[model samples]
Target: MSTFQYLLGICVAVVTFVIVIEMLRRRRLRERHAAWWLVAGALAIVVSVFPQLLDTAAGALGFDVPINLVFFVSLFVLFLVALQHSSELTELEAHNRAIVERLMVLELKLEHQLNEESQ
Candidate 1:
């Protein structure tokens, strides 16, 4: 890889790592969710610093181009992130539904008690 490309990748990776840590520190991002980003940033830094490693792996994997391999790995990482977020959203929806149901039941009970007392 070119020096410029390596430097740029490293810079981005470092920046991302720092931002994720800052967000975690600020309580803006949950630790569980930020784990994936930290891993991605570390991988980016590793891949950027070791171009030869990627080259060898690409050759072994029959990827004709290293950039293509990089793209494939990046896409897979993004897919994992998306999948994780989807799962979290699904869980949140389920929790929300349960809470709403409980609230409605509580409201109905309170209304019934009030009517009985009034009668």
Candidate 2:
């Protein structure tokens, strides 16, 4: 890689890492959500610092092009993050439904008591 390319990669990776940390500090991103990003950022930094590692990994993994390997890893990480969020959304929906049902039952009982008292 050219010196400019190497420096650019390092800068970008460092920026990503710093952004994740800033988000966490601001409470905009929960630690659970940030975990994957942090991992990705760290990996990016490592790869940026040692570009040869990418070539070696790609060769070992049977990828003809190192860039393709980077693309694949990025997609896989995104897929995992999406799957995790989907799972959490399903759980939250279940909890929300239960809470709504409980609230409805409580409201019914309260209404019944009020009717009896009035009568």
Model 2, span 16-111: residue lDDT tens: 999999999999999999999999999999999999999999999999999999999999999999999999999999999999999999999999
Error of 1 at 4 (Å): 3.2
Worst 10 residues of 2 by lDDT: 1-10
Please give the distance, in angstroms, between residue 100's alpha carbon in candidate 2 and its true position after superposition: 0.2
TM-scores of all candidate predictions against the true structure: 0.90, 0.98
Record all residue pairs in model 2 with backbone atoms less than 3 Å apart, i.e. clashing: none
lDDT of 1: 0.91
lDDT of each: 0.91, 0.99
In TM-score terms, which candidate is top? 2
Clashes of 1: 0
Reference-based lDDT, residue 52, model 2: 98
**Cα lDDT for residue 76, candidate 1:** 89
